[model samples]
Target: MKKIIPYIFLISVVSCQYFEKEVPSEQELMEKQMKEINWKEVDEYPSVADCEAISDETLRKQCFFEFLASTIQQKLSVDTLSVLYPELDTIEVRVTINPDASMQFEPQFPKDTVAYDTIKIDSILRVKLVDFPKVNPAIKRGIPVKTQFVLPVIIKTEK
Candidate 1:
Protein backbone atom coordinates (compact mmCIF):
# COMPACT_ATOMS: atom_id res chain seq x y z
CA MET A 1 0.00 0.00 0.00
CA LYS A 2 2.79 2.44 0.85
CA LYS A 3 4.62 1.79 -2.49
CA ILE A 4 1.40 2.27 -4.50
CA ILE A 5 0.62 5.57 -2.69
CA PRO A 6 3.87 7.19 -3.88
CA TYR A 7 3.22 6.11 -7.52
CA ILE A 8 -0.34 7.55 -7.33
CA PHE A 9 0.89 10.89 -6.00
CA LEU A 10 3.59 11.08 -8.71
CA ILE A 11 1.07 10.37 -11.47
CA SER A 12 -1.41 12.96 -10.11
CA VAL A 13 1.27 15.63 -9.87
CA VAL A 14 2.54 15.02 -13.43
CA SER A 15 -0.99 14.88 -14.95
CA CYS A 16 -2.41 18.01 -13.26
CA GLN A 17 -1.09 20.36 -16.02
CA TYR A 18 -2.90 18.35 -18.72
CA PHE A 19 -6.23 18.82 -16.91
CA GLU A 20 -5.80 22.60 -16.59
CA LYS A 21 -7.06 25.15 -19.17
CA GLU A 22 -5.57 28.58 -19.96
CA VAL A 23 -8.11 31.24 -19.11
CA PRO A 24 -8.32 34.14 -21.57
CA SER A 25 -7.95 37.68 -20.16
CA GLU A 26 -10.86 40.12 -20.28
CA GLN A 27 -9.20 42.11 -23.06
CA GLU A 28 -8.78 39.01 -25.17
CA LEU A 29 -12.41 38.09 -24.71
CA MET A 30 -13.49 41.59 -25.65
CA GLU A 31 -11.34 41.58 -28.78
CA LYS A 32 -12.83 38.27 -29.87
CA GLN A 33 -16.38 39.59 -29.37
CA MET A 34 -15.62 42.76 -31.28
CA LYS A 35 -14.22 40.71 -34.15
CA GLU A 36 -17.44 38.73 -34.30
CA ILE A 37 -19.54 41.87 -34.68
CA ASN A 38 -19.91 43.65 -38.01
CA TRP A 39 -19.63 47.42 -37.57
CA LYS A 40 -21.24 48.36 -40.89
CA GLU A 41 -24.31 46.16 -40.55
CA VAL A 42 -27.35 46.91 -38.39
CA ASP A 43 -30.09 44.64 -37.10
CA GLU A 44 -32.79 47.23 -37.79
CA TYR A 45 -32.89 50.57 -39.60
CA PRO A 46 -34.48 53.71 -38.21
CA SER A 47 -38.13 53.78 -39.22
CA VAL A 48 -41.33 55.80 -39.09
CA ALA A 49 -44.69 54.46 -37.94
CA ASP A 50 -45.68 53.72 -41.53
CA CYS A 51 -42.73 51.37 -42.04
CA GLU A 52 -43.25 49.20 -38.97
CA ALA A 53 -45.43 46.65 -40.78
CA ILE A 54 -42.70 45.60 -43.19
CA SER A 55 -41.41 42.10 -42.45
CA ASP A 56 -38.41 41.75 -44.68
CA GLU A 57 -35.25 43.51 -43.50
CA THR A 58 -34.19 44.88 -46.90
CA LEU A 59 -37.73 45.95 -47.75
CA ARG A 60 -38.19 47.63 -44.39
CA LYS A 61 -35.10 49.75 -44.92
CA GLN A 62 -36.22 50.62 -48.43
CA CYS A 63 -39.70 51.59 -47.29
CA PHE A 64 -38.35 53.81 -44.55
CA PHE A 65 -36.05 55.73 -46.87
CA GLU A 66 -38.66 55.99 -49.63
CA PHE A 67 -41.33 57.27 -47.28
CA LEU A 68 -38.96 59.91 -45.94
CA ALA A 69 -37.85 61.00 -49.41
CA SER A 70 -41.40 61.20 -50.70
CA THR A 71 -42.54 63.13 -47.66
CA ILE A 72 -39.62 65.52 -48.09
CA GLN A 73 -40.38 66.02 -51.77
CA GLN A 74 -44.02 66.78 -51.09
CA LYS A 75 -43.29 69.15 -48.25
CA LEU A 76 -40.56 71.04 -50.09
CA SER A 77 -42.57 71.27 -53.31
CA VAL A 78 -44.85 73.90 -51.85
CA ASP A 79 -41.93 76.01 -50.63
CA THR A 80 -39.93 78.72 -52.44
CA LEU A 81 -36.82 76.63 -53.30
CA SER A 82 -37.70 76.06 -56.93
CA VAL A 83 -38.79 79.65 -57.42
CA LEU A 84 -35.63 80.94 -55.80
CA TYR A 85 -33.33 78.61 -57.67
CA PRO A 86 -35.03 77.32 -60.79
CA GLU A 87 -31.89 75.53 -61.96
CA LEU A 88 -31.57 73.41 -58.82
CA ASP A 89 -33.10 70.08 -59.74
CA THR A 90 -32.33 67.87 -56.78
CA ILE A 91 -30.59 68.05 -53.43
CA GLU A 92 -29.15 65.32 -51.27
CA VAL A 93 -30.17 65.62 -47.64
CA ARG A 94 -28.33 63.93 -44.78
CA VAL A 95 -30.75 63.01 -42.02
CA THR A 96 -29.51 61.90 -38.64
CA ILE A 97 -31.91 60.21 -36.27
CA ASN A 98 -30.71 59.92 -32.69
CA PRO A 99 -31.35 57.11 -30.26
CA ASP A 100 -33.19 59.60 -28.08
CA ALA A 101 -35.62 60.22 -31.01
CA SER A 102 -34.21 63.65 -31.86
CA MET A 103 -33.41 64.40 -35.53
CA GLN A 104 -31.36 66.70 -37.74
CA PHE A 105 -31.29 67.51 -41.45
CA GLU A 106 -28.43 68.95 -43.48
CA PRO A 107 -28.36 69.61 -47.20
CA GLN A 108 -25.42 68.05 -49.04
CA PHE A 109 -24.02 70.07 -51.91
CA PRO A 110 -21.63 68.75 -54.51
CA LYS A 111 -18.03 69.88 -54.31
CA ASP A 112 -18.44 71.85 -57.56
CA THR A 113 -21.64 73.52 -56.43
CA VAL A 114 -21.13 77.27 -56.22
CA ALA A 115 -24.28 78.57 -57.89
CA TYR A 116 -27.06 78.03 -55.33
CA ASP A 117 -27.46 80.05 -52.15
CA THR A 118 -26.58 77.39 -49.53
CA ILE A 119 -27.86 79.35 -46.56
CA LYS A 120 -31.30 79.78 -48.08
CA ILE A 121 -31.50 76.11 -49.09
CA ASP A 122 -30.45 74.97 -45.64
CA SER A 123 -32.99 77.26 -43.99
CA ILE A 124 -35.71 76.01 -46.29
CA LEU A 125 -34.92 72.37 -45.51
CA ARG A 126 -34.88 73.06 -41.77
CA VAL A 127 -38.29 74.76 -41.89
CA LYS A 128 -39.95 72.19 -44.14
CA LEU A 129 -38.55 69.05 -42.46
CA VAL A 130 -39.74 69.81 -38.94
CA ASP A 131 -43.11 68.07 -39.29
CA PHE A 132 -41.90 64.46 -39.76
CA PRO A 133 -43.59 62.02 -37.42
CA LYS A 134 -41.60 60.52 -34.57
CA VAL A 135 -39.10 57.93 -35.82
CA ASN A 136 -38.04 54.76 -34.06
CA PRO A 137 -34.26 54.69 -33.91
CA ALA A 138 -32.16 51.89 -35.42
CA ILE A 139 -31.33 48.76 -33.42
CA LYS A 140 -28.03 46.98 -32.99
CA ARG A 141 -27.87 43.95 -30.74
CA GLY A 142 -31.36 44.85 -29.47
CA ILE A 143 -30.19 48.29 -28.31
CA PRO A 144 -31.44 51.50 -29.90
CA VAL A 145 -28.74 53.23 -31.98
CA LYS A 146 -28.37 56.46 -33.93
CA THR A 147 -28.42 56.27 -37.74
CA GLN A 148 -27.52 58.72 -40.47
CA PHE A 149 -28.67 58.41 -44.07
CA VAL A 150 -28.79 60.57 -47.17
CA LEU A 151 -31.96 60.96 -49.26
CA PRO A 152 -32.24 62.54 -52.65
CA VAL A 153 -35.10 65.05 -52.90
CA ILE A 154 -36.11 66.20 -56.36
CA ILE A 155 -37.50 69.67 -56.96
CA LYS A 156 -40.57 69.79 -59.17
CA THR A 157 -42.50 72.85 -60.21
CA GLU A 158 -45.25 73.18 -62.82
CA LYS A 159 -45.33 76.26 -65.03
Candidate 2:
Protein backbone atom coordinates (compact mmCIF):
# COMPACT_ATOMS: atom_id res chain seq x y z
CA MET A 1 0.00 0.00 0.00
CA LYS A 2 2.85 2.46 0.81
CA LYS A 3 4.52 1.86 -2.58
CA ILE A 4 1.17 2.36 -4.37
CA ILE A 5 0.63 5.78 -2.68
CA PRO A 6 3.98 7.20 -3.92
CA TYR A 7 3.29 5.90 -7.49
CA ILE A 8 -0.20 7.52 -7.54
CA PHE A 9 1.19 10.89 -6.38
CA LEU A 10 3.83 10.84 -9.13
CA ILE A 11 1.19 9.98 -11.76
CA SER A 12 -1.10 12.80 -10.58
CA VAL A 13 1.69 15.48 -10.74
CA VAL A 14 2.69 14.42 -14.24
CA SER A 15 -0.91 14.29 -15.44
CA CYS A 16 -1.64 17.85 -14.14
CA GLN A 17 1.23 19.30 -16.22
CA TYR A 18 -0.32 17.87 -19.41
CA PHE A 19 -3.80 19.14 -18.40
CA GLU A 20 -2.66 22.75 -17.92
CA LYS A 21 -4.12 25.14 -20.53
CA GLU A 22 -1.74 27.45 -22.40
CA VAL A 23 -2.77 31.11 -22.35
CA PRO A 24 -3.07 32.62 -25.81
CA SER A 25 -0.69 35.44 -26.78
CA GLU A 26 -2.09 38.98 -26.99
CA GLN A 27 -1.97 39.08 -30.81
CA GLU A 28 -3.65 35.69 -31.09
CA LEU A 29 -6.47 36.82 -28.79
CA MET A 30 -6.97 40.00 -30.79
CA GLU A 31 -7.09 38.10 -34.05
CA LYS A 32 -9.71 35.74 -32.64
CA GLN A 33 -11.85 38.66 -31.41
CA MET A 34 -11.64 40.39 -34.77
CA LYS A 35 -12.84 37.25 -36.50
CA GLU A 36 -15.92 37.19 -34.27
CA ILE A 37 -17.14 40.57 -35.52
CA ASN A 38 -19.48 40.23 -38.49
CA TRP A 39 -19.58 43.09 -41.00
CA LYS A 40 -22.28 41.75 -43.31
CA GLU A 41 -25.15 41.43 -40.87
CA VAL A 42 -27.22 44.23 -39.36
CA ASP A 43 -29.16 43.69 -36.14
CA GLU A 44 -32.23 45.19 -37.76
CA TYR A 45 -33.11 46.24 -41.29
CA PRO A 46 -34.18 49.74 -42.34
CA SER A 47 -37.95 49.80 -42.48
CA VAL A 48 -40.74 52.19 -43.40
CA ALA A 49 -43.42 52.88 -40.82
CA ASP A 50 -45.79 50.48 -42.57
CA CYS A 51 -43.24 47.68 -42.43
CA GLU A 52 -42.14 48.10 -38.85
CA ALA A 53 -44.56 45.50 -37.57
CA ILE A 54 -43.24 42.70 -39.74
CA SER A 55 -41.42 39.93 -37.80
CA ASP A 56 -39.68 38.10 -40.62
CA GLU A 57 -36.53 39.85 -41.84
CA THR A 58 -36.93 38.89 -45.51
CA LEU A 59 -40.56 39.99 -45.51
CA ARG A 60 -39.68 43.21 -43.73
CA LYS A 61 -37.10 44.03 -46.41
CA GLN A 62 -39.56 43.25 -49.18
CA CYS A 63 -42.21 45.39 -47.52
CA PHE A 64 -39.82 48.28 -47.16
CA PHE A 65 -38.95 48.15 -50.87
CA GLU A 66 -42.58 48.05 -51.90
CA PHE A 67 -43.49 50.88 -49.59
CA LEU A 68 -40.59 53.00 -50.82
CA ALA A 69 -41.37 52.42 -54.52
CA SER A 70 -45.05 53.08 -54.00
CA THR A 71 -44.37 56.27 -52.11
CA ILE A 72 -41.88 57.52 -54.72
CA GLN A 73 -44.24 56.67 -57.57
CA GLN A 74 -47.15 58.38 -55.86
CA LYS A 75 -45.23 61.57 -55.30
CA LEU A 76 -43.42 61.57 -58.64
CA SER A 77 -46.60 60.87 -60.61
CA VAL A 78 -47.71 64.40 -59.75
CA ASP A 79 -44.56 65.92 -61.28
CA THR A 80 -44.59 65.79 -65.09
CA LEU A 81 -40.97 66.89 -65.28
CA SER A 82 -39.80 63.89 -63.31
CA VAL A 83 -41.32 61.34 -65.66
CA LEU A 84 -40.62 63.14 -68.93
CA TYR A 85 -37.25 64.63 -69.69
CA PRO A 86 -35.68 65.19 -73.11
CA GLU A 87 -33.53 62.16 -74.10
CA LEU A 88 -33.70 60.68 -70.61
CA ASP A 89 -33.31 56.92 -70.82
CA THR A 90 -32.82 55.16 -67.48
CA ILE A 91 -31.00 56.44 -64.48
CA GLU A 92 -29.82 54.75 -61.31
CA VAL A 93 -30.30 56.76 -58.16
CA ARG A 94 -28.50 56.13 -54.91
CA VAL A 95 -30.77 56.94 -52.00
CA THR A 96 -29.36 57.06 -48.51
CA ILE A 97 -31.62 57.23 -45.50
CA ASN A 98 -29.91 58.87 -42.57
CA PRO A 99 -30.35 57.94 -38.93
CA ASP A 100 -32.64 60.97 -38.55
CA ALA A 101 -34.84 59.92 -41.51
CA SER A 102 -33.51 62.57 -43.91
CA MET A 103 -32.36 61.41 -47.36
CA GLN A 104 -29.39 62.03 -49.66
CA PHE A 105 -29.75 61.46 -53.41
CA GLU A 106 -27.14 60.76 -56.05
CA PRO A 107 -28.22 60.20 -59.64
CA GLN A 108 -26.25 58.39 -62.35
CA PHE A 109 -27.20 58.70 -65.98
CA PRO A 110 -25.73 57.04 -69.04
CA LYS A 111 -23.27 59.12 -71.12
CA ASP A 112 -25.07 58.28 -74.35
CA THR A 113 -28.16 60.27 -73.30
CA VAL A 114 -28.55 63.97 -73.99
CA ALA A 115 -27.33 66.25 -71.26
CA TYR A 116 -29.92 67.29 -68.72
CA ASP A 117 -29.85 69.80 -65.89
CA THR A 118 -28.80 67.94 -62.74
CA ILE A 119 -29.86 70.79 -60.47
CA LYS A 120 -33.46 70.37 -61.54
CA ILE A 121 -33.35 66.64 -60.86
CA ASP A 122 -31.78 67.21 -57.47
CA SER A 123 -34.40 69.75 -56.48
CA ILE A 124 -37.25 67.50 -57.61
CA LEU A 125 -35.85 64.56 -55.71
CA ARG A 126 -35.32 66.69 -52.63
CA VAL A 127 -38.92 67.82 -52.68
CA LYS A 128 -40.22 64.31 -53.23
CA LEU A 129 -38.07 62.94 -50.41
CA VAL A 130 -39.49 65.49 -48.03
CA ASP A 131 -42.86 63.83 -48.53
CA PHE A 132 -41.52 60.34 -48.07
CA PRO A 133 -42.77 58.36 -45.10
CA LYS A 134 -40.48 58.39 -42.11
CA VAL A 135 -38.30 55.32 -41.75
CA ASN A 136 -36.57 53.41 -38.99
CA PRO A 137 -32.89 53.42 -39.79
CA ALA A 138 -30.97 50.19 -39.94
CA ILE A 139 -29.50 48.96 -36.65
CA LYS A 140 -26.02 47.61 -36.15
CA ARG A 141 -25.27 46.33 -32.68
CA GLY A 142 -28.37 48.08 -31.37
CA ILE A 143 -27.44 51.47 -32.81
CA PRO A 144 -29.31 53.29 -35.57
CA VAL A 145 -27.32 53.63 -38.78
CA LYS A 146 -27.67 55.20 -42.22
CA THR A 147 -28.57 52.82 -45.06
CA GLN A 148 -28.14 53.23 -48.82
CA PHE A 149 -30.12 51.77 -51.68
CA VAL A 150 -29.59 51.98 -55.44
CA LEU A 151 -32.86 52.14 -57.36
CA PRO A 152 -33.36 52.16 -61.09
CA VAL A 153 -35.78 54.69 -62.57
CA ILE A 154 -36.90 53.96 -66.11
CA ILE A 155 -38.12 56.73 -68.40
CA LYS A 156 -40.63 55.79 -71.10
CA THR A 157 -41.33 58.04 -74.05
CA GLU A 158 -44.68 58.16 -75.85
CA LYS A 159 -44.61 56.49 -79.28
Candidate 3:
Protein backbone atom coordinates (compact mmCIF):
# COMPACT_ATOMS: atom_id res chain seq x y z
CA MET A 1 0.00 0.00 0.00
CA LYS A 2 2.83 2.45 0.73
CA LYS A 3 4.41 1.86 -2.68
CA ILE A 4 1.09 2.49 -4.38
CA ILE A 5 0.68 5.81 -2.55
CA PRO A 6 3.97 7.22 -3.93
CA TYR A 7 3.12 6.02 -7.45
CA ILE A 8 -0.29 7.70 -7.24
CA PHE A 9 1.25 11.02 -6.17
CA LEU A 10 3.79 10.88 -9.03
CA ILE A 11 1.07 10.15 -11.52
CA SER A 12 -0.96 13.09 -10.25
CA VAL A 13 1.98 15.44 -10.62
CA VAL A 14 2.73 14.28 -14.21
CA SER A 15 -0.90 14.57 -15.22
CA CYS A 16 -1.11 18.10 -13.83
CA GLN A 17 1.88 19.16 -15.96
CA TYR A 18 0.24 17.73 -19.08
CA PHE A 19 -2.96 19.68 -18.37
CA GLU A 20 -1.28 23.06 -17.95
CA LYS A 21 -3.07 25.93 -19.76
CA GLU A 22 -1.26 28.25 -22.12
CA VAL A 23 -1.50 32.05 -21.74
CA PRO A 24 -1.26 34.38 -24.71
CA SER A 25 1.97 36.39 -24.93
CA GLU A 26 1.97 40.21 -25.11
CA GLN A 27 3.22 40.21 -28.70
CA GLU A 28 0.35 37.96 -29.79
CA LEU A 29 -2.18 40.24 -28.10
CA MET A 30 -0.75 43.31 -29.74
CA GLU A 31 -0.85 41.67 -33.18
CA LYS A 32 -4.48 40.71 -32.70
CA GLN A 33 -5.40 44.23 -31.65
CA MET A 34 -3.60 45.76 -34.62
CA LYS A 35 -5.42 43.46 -37.02
CA GLU A 36 -8.77 44.51 -35.57
CA ILE A 37 -7.89 48.20 -35.89
CA ASN A 38 -6.76 48.06 -39.54
CA TRP A 39 -9.52 49.01 -41.92
CA LYS A 40 -9.92 47.83 -45.51
CA GLU A 41 -10.32 50.52 -48.17
CA VAL A 42 -13.34 50.72 -50.43
CA ASP A 43 -12.74 50.17 -54.13
CA GLU A 44 -12.92 53.17 -56.50
CA TYR A 45 -14.84 53.41 -59.78
CA PRO A 46 -13.28 54.11 -63.18
CA SER A 47 -12.54 57.79 -63.98
CA VAL A 48 -14.43 60.20 -66.31
CA ALA A 49 -11.70 60.10 -68.98
CA ASP A 50 -12.59 56.42 -69.32
CA CYS A 51 -16.19 57.40 -70.10
CA GLU A 52 -15.33 60.12 -72.65
CA ALA A 53 -13.18 57.72 -74.69
CA ILE A 54 -16.08 55.51 -75.73
CA SER A 55 -17.10 56.58 -79.23
CA ASP A 56 -20.57 54.96 -79.13
CA GLU A 57 -22.70 56.82 -76.62
CA THR A 58 -24.80 53.80 -75.79
CA LEU A 59 -21.95 51.28 -75.67
CA ARG A 60 -19.81 53.72 -73.70
CA LYS A 61 -22.40 54.04 -70.95
CA GLN A 62 -22.93 50.30 -70.84
CA CYS A 63 -19.21 49.57 -70.72
CA PHE A 64 -18.55 52.18 -68.04
CA PHE A 65 -21.01 50.65 -65.59
CA GLU A 66 -20.11 47.11 -66.55
CA PHE A 67 -16.43 47.75 -65.87
CA LEU A 68 -17.11 49.10 -62.40
CA ALA A 69 -19.44 46.25 -61.52
CA SER A 70 -16.99 43.70 -62.81
CA THR A 71 -14.18 45.13 -60.70
CA ILE A 72 -16.28 44.98 -57.55
CA GLN A 73 -17.33 41.42 -58.29
CA GLN A 74 -13.74 40.37 -58.88
CA LYS A 75 -12.62 41.87 -55.58
CA LEU A 76 -15.41 40.19 -53.65
CA SER A 77 -14.75 36.85 -55.29
CA VAL A 78 -11.09 37.02 -54.32
CA ASP A 79 -11.86 38.04 -50.74
CA THR A 80 -14.71 35.63 -49.87
CA LEU A 81 -14.56 32.45 -51.94
CA SER A 82 -10.84 31.70 -51.62
CA VAL A 83 -11.06 31.35 -47.85
CA LEU A 84 -14.37 29.45 -47.51
CA TYR A 85 -14.25 26.87 -50.31
CA PRO A 86 -10.81 25.69 -51.28
CA GLU A 87 -12.33 22.76 -53.16
CA LEU A 88 -13.96 24.98 -55.77
CA ASP A 89 -11.81 24.04 -58.75
CA THR A 90 -12.40 26.94 -61.15
CA ILE A 91 -14.34 30.11 -62.04
CA GLU A 92 -15.66 30.98 -65.50
CA VAL A 93 -16.11 34.46 -67.02
CA ARG A 94 -17.90 35.42 -70.23
CA VAL A 95 -17.28 38.44 -72.44
CA THR A 96 -19.36 39.67 -75.38
CA ILE A 97 -18.24 42.00 -78.17
CA ASN A 98 -20.49 43.70 -80.70
CA PRO A 99 -20.39 42.53 -84.33
CA ASP A 100 -18.57 45.67 -85.49
CA ALA A 101 -16.05 45.67 -82.61
CA SER A 102 -13.04 43.61 -81.46
CA MET A 103 -12.00 43.16 -77.82
CA GLN A 104 -9.47 41.38 -75.60
CA PHE A 105 -9.27 40.29 -71.95
CA GLU A 106 -6.17 40.79 -69.80
CA PRO A 107 -5.96 38.89 -66.49
CA GLN A 108 -3.36 40.03 -63.98
CA PHE A 109 -2.21 38.04 -60.94
CA PRO A 110 0.43 39.01 -58.36
CA LYS A 111 4.12 38.89 -59.33
CA ASP A 112 4.97 35.83 -57.20
CA THR A 113 1.82 33.98 -58.24
CA VAL A 114 2.53 30.52 -59.68
CA ALA A 115 -0.77 29.60 -61.35
CA TYR A 116 -0.72 30.00 -65.12
CA ASP A 117 -3.60 29.68 -67.60
CA THR A 118 -4.35 30.95 -71.08
CA ILE A 119 -7.31 33.21 -71.89
CA LYS A 120 -8.81 32.64 -75.32
CA ILE A 121 -10.59 35.64 -76.85
CA ASP A 122 -13.33 34.46 -79.22
CA SER A 123 -13.09 35.31 -82.91
CA ILE A 124 -16.23 37.39 -82.48
CA LEU A 125 -14.69 39.29 -79.53
CA ARG A 126 -17.07 37.76 -76.97
CA VAL A 127 -16.00 35.73 -73.96
CA LYS A 128 -18.64 33.22 -72.89
CA LEU A 129 -17.28 32.56 -69.37
CA VAL A 130 -14.02 32.31 -67.48
CA ASP A 131 -13.43 29.77 -64.70
CA PHE A 132 -11.13 30.66 -61.80
CA PRO A 133 -10.82 27.97 -59.11
CA LYS A 134 -8.75 30.23 -56.92
CA VAL A 135 -11.52 32.85 -56.85
CA ASN A 136 -13.21 33.79 -53.54
CA PRO A 137 -16.87 32.91 -52.88
CA ALA A 138 -17.91 36.56 -52.38
CA ILE A 139 -16.61 37.37 -55.85
CA LYS A 140 -18.20 34.23 -57.31
CA ARG A 141 -21.63 35.35 -56.12
CA GLY A 142 -21.08 38.73 -57.77
CA ILE A 143 -20.28 37.09 -61.12
CA PRO A 144 -23.92 36.69 -62.07
CA VAL A 145 -24.54 40.35 -61.21
CA LYS A 146 -23.43 42.48 -64.14
CA THR A 147 -22.61 46.22 -64.48
CA GLN A 148 -22.84 47.82 -67.94
CA PHE A 149 -19.97 49.89 -69.44
CA VAL A 150 -19.66 51.90 -72.64
CA LEU A 151 -17.26 50.97 -75.48
CA PRO A 152 -15.26 53.85 -76.99
CA VAL A 153 -14.67 52.31 -80.43
CA ILE A 154 -15.30 54.84 -83.21
CA ILE A 155 -17.39 54.06 -86.27
CA LYS A 156 -15.45 53.29 -89.40
CA THR A 157 -15.86 55.55 -92.46
CA GLU A 158 -16.14 53.68 -95.74
CA LYS A 159 -15.91 55.58 -99.07
Candidate 4:
Protein backbone atom coordinates (compact mmCIF):
# COMPACT_ATOMS: atom_id res chain seq x y z
CA MET A 1 0.00 0.00 0.00
CA LYS A 2 2.87 2.40 0.84
CA LYS A 3 4.68 1.77 -2.48
CA ILE A 4 1.40 2.14 -4.40
CA ILE A 5 0.74 5.55 -2.75
CA PRO A 6 4.18 6.92 -3.92
CA TYR A 7 3.61 5.68 -7.47
CA ILE A 8 0.16 7.27 -7.53
CA PHE A 9 1.55 10.61 -6.28
CA LEU A 10 4.31 10.56 -8.93
CA ILE A 11 1.75 9.80 -11.63
CA SER A 12 -0.52 12.62 -10.41
CA VAL A 13 2.33 15.16 -10.51
CA VAL A 14 3.36 14.16 -14.05
CA SER A 15 -0.25 14.20 -15.31
CA CYS A 16 -0.65 17.82 -14.15
CA GLN A 17 1.71 18.93 -16.99
CA TYR A 18 -0.63 17.36 -19.54
CA PHE A 19 -3.53 19.54 -18.35
CA GLU A 20 -1.40 22.75 -18.24
CA LYS A 21 0.03 22.43 -21.76
CA GLU A 22 -2.19 23.30 -24.70
CA VAL A 23 -2.96 21.17 -27.74
CA PRO A 24 -3.37 23.80 -30.42
CA SER A 25 -6.75 24.29 -32.04
CA GLU A 26 -7.23 23.63 -35.77
CA GLN A 27 -7.47 27.35 -36.55
CA GLU A 28 -4.26 28.11 -34.69
CA LEU A 29 -2.42 25.36 -36.55
CA MET A 30 -3.74 26.62 -39.86
CA GLU A 31 -2.76 30.20 -39.11
CA LYS A 32 0.77 29.12 -38.19
CA GLN A 33 1.14 27.20 -41.48
CA MET A 34 -0.20 30.13 -43.49
CA LYS A 35 2.29 32.49 -41.89
CA GLU A 36 5.16 30.10 -42.64
CA ILE A 37 4.29 29.92 -46.35
CA ASN A 38 5.97 32.30 -48.84
CA TRP A 39 3.19 34.37 -50.35
CA LYS A 40 5.43 36.77 -52.29
CA GLU A 41 6.61 34.20 -54.84
CA VAL A 42 5.34 31.10 -56.58
CA ASP A 43 7.20 27.79 -56.60
CA GLU A 44 6.86 27.59 -60.40
CA TYR A 45 6.07 30.19 -63.04
CA PRO A 46 3.36 29.58 -65.66
CA SER A 47 4.65 27.69 -68.67
CA VAL A 48 3.64 26.76 -72.22
CA ALA A 49 4.24 23.37 -73.84
CA ASP A 50 7.60 24.58 -75.21
CA CYS A 51 8.90 25.36 -71.75
CA GLU A 52 7.45 22.37 -69.90
CA ALA A 53 10.48 20.09 -70.20
CA ILE A 54 13.11 22.60 -69.03
CA SER A 55 14.47 21.43 -65.66
CA ASP A 56 16.33 24.62 -64.67
CA GLU A 57 14.01 27.14 -63.06
CA THR A 58 15.73 30.25 -64.44
CA LEU A 59 15.97 28.89 -67.98
CA ARG A 60 12.37 27.74 -67.85
CA LYS A 61 11.21 31.19 -66.83
CA GLN A 62 13.32 32.80 -69.55
CA CYS A 63 11.91 30.47 -72.18
CA PHE A 64 8.35 31.23 -71.14
CA PHE A 65 8.92 35.00 -71.18
CA GLU A 66 10.67 34.88 -74.54
CA PHE A 67 7.92 32.75 -76.01
CA LEU A 68 5.26 35.17 -74.77
CA ALA A 69 7.13 38.23 -76.03
CA SER A 70 7.68 36.77 -79.51
CA THR A 71 4.07 35.64 -79.69
CA ILE A 72 2.84 39.10 -78.72
CA GLN A 73 5.13 40.73 -81.25
CA GLN A 74 3.92 38.40 -83.98
CA LYS A 75 0.26 38.94 -83.17
CA LEU A 76 0.46 42.69 -82.82
CA SER A 77 2.35 43.07 -86.07
CA VAL A 78 -0.79 42.19 -88.02
CA ASP A 79 -2.61 45.16 -86.55
CA THR A 80 -2.53 48.63 -88.19
CA LEU A 81 -0.94 50.04 -85.04
CA SER A 82 1.93 51.69 -86.91
CA VAL A 83 -0.41 53.48 -89.28
CA LEU A 84 -2.84 54.46 -86.50
CA TYR A 85 -0.41 55.36 -83.72
CA PRO A 86 3.07 55.66 -85.11
CA GLU A 87 4.44 57.44 -82.02
CA LEU A 88 3.38 54.67 -79.64
CA ASP A 89 6.34 52.30 -79.89
CA THR A 90 5.85 50.41 -76.67
CA ILE A 91 3.11 49.50 -74.21
CA GLU A 92 2.87 47.97 -70.80
CA VAL A 93 0.21 45.28 -70.42
CA ARG A 94 -1.06 43.67 -67.28
CA VAL A 95 -1.54 39.94 -67.73
CA THR A 96 -3.39 37.69 -65.32
CA ILE A 97 -3.18 33.92 -65.38
CA ASN A 98 -5.75 32.00 -63.38
CA PRO A 99 -5.31 28.68 -61.65
CA ASP A 100 -7.70 27.12 -64.15
CA ALA A 101 -5.24 27.87 -67.00
CA SER A 102 -7.13 30.88 -68.26
CA MET A 103 -5.72 34.34 -68.97
CA GLN A 104 -6.70 38.00 -69.23
CA PHE A 105 -4.86 41.07 -70.50
CA GLU A 106 -5.32 44.81 -70.12
CA PRO A 107 -3.17 47.65 -71.35
CA GLN A 108 -1.62 49.77 -68.62
CA PHE A 109 -1.75 53.40 -69.62
CA PRO A 110 -0.45 56.44 -67.82
CA LYS A 111 -2.95 58.62 -65.93
CA ASP A 112 -2.34 61.63 -68.19
CA THR A 113 -2.87 59.66 -71.44
CA VAL A 114 -5.41 60.83 -74.00
CA ALA A 115 -8.62 58.79 -74.14
CA TYR A 116 -8.70 58.50 -77.94
CA ASP A 117 -5.35 56.76 -78.24
CA THR A 118 -6.09 54.60 -75.23
CA ILE A 119 -9.39 53.45 -76.70
CA LYS A 120 -7.88 52.67 -80.08
CA ILE A 121 -4.86 50.88 -78.64
CA ASP A 122 -7.08 48.82 -76.34
CA SER A 123 -9.25 47.69 -79.19
CA ILE A 124 -6.24 46.78 -81.28
CA LEU A 125 -4.84 44.64 -78.45
CA ARG A 126 -8.16 42.88 -77.91
CA VAL A 127 -8.53 42.11 -81.61
CA LYS A 128 -4.93 41.08 -82.21
CA LEU A 129 -4.16 39.10 -79.05
CA VAL A 130 -6.42 36.07 -79.25
CA ASP A 131 -6.27 32.31 -79.64
CA PHE A 132 -3.09 31.90 -77.62
CA PRO A 133 -1.75 28.42 -76.84
CA LYS A 134 -2.68 26.98 -73.47
CA VAL A 135 -0.56 27.97 -70.50
CA ASN A 136 -0.05 25.88 -67.35
CA PRO A 137 -0.75 28.05 -64.34
CA ALA A 138 1.80 28.99 -61.73
CA ILE A 139 2.27 26.70 -58.73
CA LYS A 140 2.79 27.42 -55.05
CA ARG A 141 3.41 24.67 -52.54
CA GLY A 142 2.34 22.08 -55.12
CA ILE A 143 -0.99 23.84 -55.77
CA PRO A 144 -1.89 25.96 -58.78
CA VAL A 145 -2.16 29.69 -58.03
CA LYS A 146 -3.25 32.79 -59.95
CA THR A 147 -0.53 35.26 -60.93
CA GLN A 148 -0.58 38.75 -62.38
CA PHE A 149 2.33 40.71 -63.86
CA VAL A 150 3.08 43.68 -66.05
CA LEU A 151 4.98 43.10 -69.29
CA PRO A 152 6.52 45.79 -71.43
CA VAL A 153 5.90 44.77 -75.04
CA ILE A 154 7.61 46.59 -77.84
CA ILE A 155 4.96 47.61 -80.33
CA LYS A 156 7.51 47.82 -83.14
CA THR A 157 9.86 44.87 -83.19
CA GLU A 158 11.72 46.35 -86.16
CA LYS A 159 12.77 49.31 -84.04
Best by lDDT: 1
Candidate rank order under TM-score: 1, 4, 2, 3
TM-scores of the models, in the order given: 0.87, 0.79, 0.22, 0.84
Model 3: weakest 10-residue lDDT segment is: 132-141
Regions more than 4 Å wrong, model 1: 1-13
- Model 3 spans > 4 angstroms off: 30-159
lDDT value, candidate 1, whole model: 0.90
Tens digits of per-residue lDDT for model 1 on 1-159? Answer: 999999999999999999999999999999999999998878888988888998998898899888888888999999999899998889999999999989999999988988988988999899998868888999999999888888888989879
Please report, in order, the local distance difference test score of every candidate based on alpha carbons. Answer: 0.90, 0.75, 0.40, 0.88
Q: Roughly what TM-score does model 1 have, to 2 decimal places?
A: 0.87
Task: Point out the higher-scoring one by TM-score: 2 or 3.
Answer: 2
The window of 10 residues in a row where model 2 has the poorest summed lDDT is 81-90
Residue-wise C-alpha lDDT for candidate 3, range 52-125, written one tens digit per residue: 56777567556655654455355434343334434433433332332223223333334674443232212111
Best by TM-score: 1
lDDT of model 3 at residue 33?
A: 85
Alpha carbon deviation, residue 107, candidate 2 (Å) = 1.9
